[model samples]
Target: MNKRKIIDRTLLTDLAKDVGLNASHLEALGESCQWEIGVDGDMLERLVEIQHQFERLAVMGDDEYRGFYIEVPRPAPEEWGDAEELIASGEYDSREAFLADWLAFNPMETRWFHVASNRYGDSRSIRVTDRKHTHFIITNHSKCTDAEPDDTWCRENLTRLFDYLQRMIDVIVANPDGFNDYVAHNLPYQQRTGRIAQKEFNRIVPNCKIEVEDKETAIKALEDSVHGRSVPPLETMTIRQYCSYYRIANEAYEAYYRKRGASGRFYEDPQDVPEELRDVAYYKRIKFVDEEILYDIDSPEDFIRFATDHYGELGLSRLNIFASNKRQKGWMIIVSNSYSANVGLAIEVATALYKARAPLLIYDAEKLLRILLEEDYVRLVPDSYHNYMGYQEEGSVYELPWEYECSEDTDSVLNKEQYQAIISNAEWQPEEQAKPIA
Candidate 1:
C-alpha cells in the first residue's frame, strides 16, 4: 500500500510564516514535526498527554500560573451522564438508540482523532476506539474550562484546526507533474496572453444595462433588479388594461374618420389625417395585437415564438407608458394597482413563450415563480383545495375559488364511483364566479 506524502517542510515553513507567531511557536513543540513524517501510535499517545496538560492550563489565570501551573478538575468517564439511564427512563428505546439521539443533538462534537496546538502551548486531542466495528470515544480532552467551552473558545479552536488541515490537503492535492508539463508547453507567454485576451474582451463588451435577447434572460435580469431594489414600481397600465385603452382609441379614430367621409384615405398616414385627429388615428393604428397572439397560444413552444417576434414591441410599449410627456392616454387601472403587479405574470407568460420557441434553453418554472414571490411581483394565493396555486393579487382570487362545500346528504346520494364520475366530467369556469369589486 502506498502512503500519500504529507506536505513538504518548505510548504509547512511557508504556512507557519503565513499564520505568524502562534503557529511558529506551535511548530517548535516537536509534536507537529512528528506529524510531518506520519501520525504514529507514539505520537498519538504523546498528543493525548499534551492535550491533558493544555486542559489543565486553560482554567488557570496569569496570577495562578505565576510560579507553577494549576491543574483544572474535569469529570471522569464514570461521572459522565449515563446513556442506559436515559433508555431506562423511556427517553430512548435502547442504548444504541440513545447514543444515536445524542450524536444527532451534538453534531458539532468531533468524533475523529486529531490534534490541535497554539502559541501558549495549549493543545487538544481526541481519540476514538473501535470495538467490534462500533466506534466509541476513548479519550476526548480539550484545554478549555467548562465555562470557556460554552463560549467562542471551542469554535475558534475548531476553525484553527480546520485551517491547518485545509493547508495540508491543499499541498497533498497539488500536481507537480501536471504543473511541470503545463510550464513546458505554455512557457512565459501563457500568463501575458490570458491577461491580454481578458482585457480585450472586457473592452469590447463594456458593462451597461443587460440587453434582454430572450425571455429567460429578461426574466433573470428583472428578478435580479427586483432583489437589488433597482426595479422601480411600474407606474403605468397592465397589458390587459392597456389593450382595452388601445381598442377605445381605435374606435374613436374610426368614428372621427367615418364622420369626415375619409374611408378611402383611411389607410393613409395618420399625419395626413387632420392635425386634431392625428393623435386618434395614430393610436388606432398602434398594433396592440398581443391579445390575438396570446389567445391562440396553446403551448409553451408557441408562446416563445410569439414573444421572440414581438419582443421589441412588447418592451417598447412597457417603456413608452412611463416616458415623460408621452401622448398615450386613457389607461385605466385594471386588474392591478400598477404595471409592476402584472410584471410577474408577464414574465411567466413571456418565459413560457420563449421556452416554446427555444426548447434548448433550460427553463425552471418553479425557480422563476420563487423569484417572483421573493420580489413581491407575485404572491402565493392560498387555496383549501389545491396545494400549489399562485397569482398576482388578492383581487385575482376570483380566478381561483375554494372548492364548493358539498352537504353530507349530497355525498350519501352520490356513491363514491358516481361522485368520481361527476368530478371527472365537471368543467371549471371562471366566468361563473361573481366579478371582484375593484
Candidate 2:
C-alpha cells in the first residue's frame, strides 16, 4: 500500500485558521512531531483537511462549476414565440390559453424564475410568457446535474457542508467543564439537547390518561366544546374537557347579563351556581326583592313612605313624591325649584313599576308642563307667583286634570278657573320659550 504523505505543520496551521481554530496550537506542534504522530493520533488532522476541501468546493466560481457539470440543454431562442406566432402555428388560441399550456409543462422552471427574480430585484412585472424556453434556460445555466438542479444541491449542501468545520471549532472553543456536553450535542446524530437520559425524557413527556393513538379523537372533542359546536359528555373529563366546561359556563354567565340588562353585580359564589343559570339566577333573586317592595304599594303615598324609610335623605332628592285623589284622579307632585331632576332615578323607578305589572305613564316635570300647555287642561293665573316652588306650599302651584294622572285613583278634581289661572301665570314654559330650569 502507498503510504499517505505527512501534512506539513505550516499547512495544518493554515487549515486551523480557515476553520476558525487556534493556529498557535498547531504551529507549536512543529514539522518533526507532525511526522512522528501515529495514524490514530492524526485523525482530527485529517478531518480538518477534508473540511478545507469542502470549503474550496463551496466558494468555486459559478461559471467554472457550470462548465464542469452536465446540464439539460437549452431550447433555441426561436422556440420562445410570441402570442401572434403561437396562434398562427395552431399551438394556442389566446395569450391566456398559451400561458396555461406553458405553465403546465414547466411548473418547476416558473417557480425558479420567481425565486431568482425575487432574490435579485423587483419581480412584480416579470411573468412566465414562454415556460418551455424559460425552463431550458434555467436548467442549462444551473451548476448541477439534470437530476438534482442548482437549488436542490444548495439545499442539501448549504448547511451540511459547513457542519464538520463548525463542530470542530465548537469543541476547540468550548469551556473545559462543558467540553464533553459540547461533543455529545454537536457531533453527528446527536441533535436533541435536553433530557438525553431515558429516565429524564420519560419524566418530562408523561403518558396521557388517553392512549397516544386516541389523542386525536380526544383533541377533536375538546375543540368542539371550545368552539361551541357540541358539548362533550361530562363523564369523559380530561384537562382539555374541563377547560371547555369552564368556557361554556363563563359564556352562559355573559349571555344572561346581556339578555336581562347588566346589573353590575356578579354572582357571589360562581363555583356553587349551576352552569346553565349561573348568571341569570343571581340577578333574578335580587330583582324579585325589589319587585315585591314596589308591588305592595297600592298608592303613591305608600311609594313615597317606602322610599323615605328605606333610602332616607339620599332618596329624598331623587323622589318626586306625588299624590292623586281617590276619585277624578289628578297627581299632585312635590318638587323643589333648586334641585335638578335625576333622569336615572326616573328610568329606575319606571323599570321597577313595569316589572311590578304596572302600566308606564310617568313623565318628568318638563314633560308634565308640556302636556298641560298642549292640551289646554289648565290656564295660567296672572295674580299668583309665576315662579312658585312646588315644595313650598301644598296647593299653591300648577294644576292639571285627571288625564295627567299616572295612578288608579279618580277622586280628585280641579275647578276650571284654578286650572286656567295656574296655566296662564305659571312660569313652567316649554323648553323653547323658557330659560334653563334653576
- Candidate achieving the largest TM-score: 1
lDDT of 2 by residue, 32-138 (tens): 22212212123333423433332322222232220010011111123334767878898888877877665454332111110011011211110111111121111
Candidate 2 Cα RMSD (Å):
37.9
Question: Residue 135, candidate 1: how far off, in angstroms?
Answer: 28
Leading candidate by lDDT:
1
CA lDDT, every prediction? Answer: 0.31, 0.28
Candidate 2 weakest lDDT stretch, 10 residues: 110-119
- Give the CA lDDT, 0 to 100, for residue 203 in model 1: 32
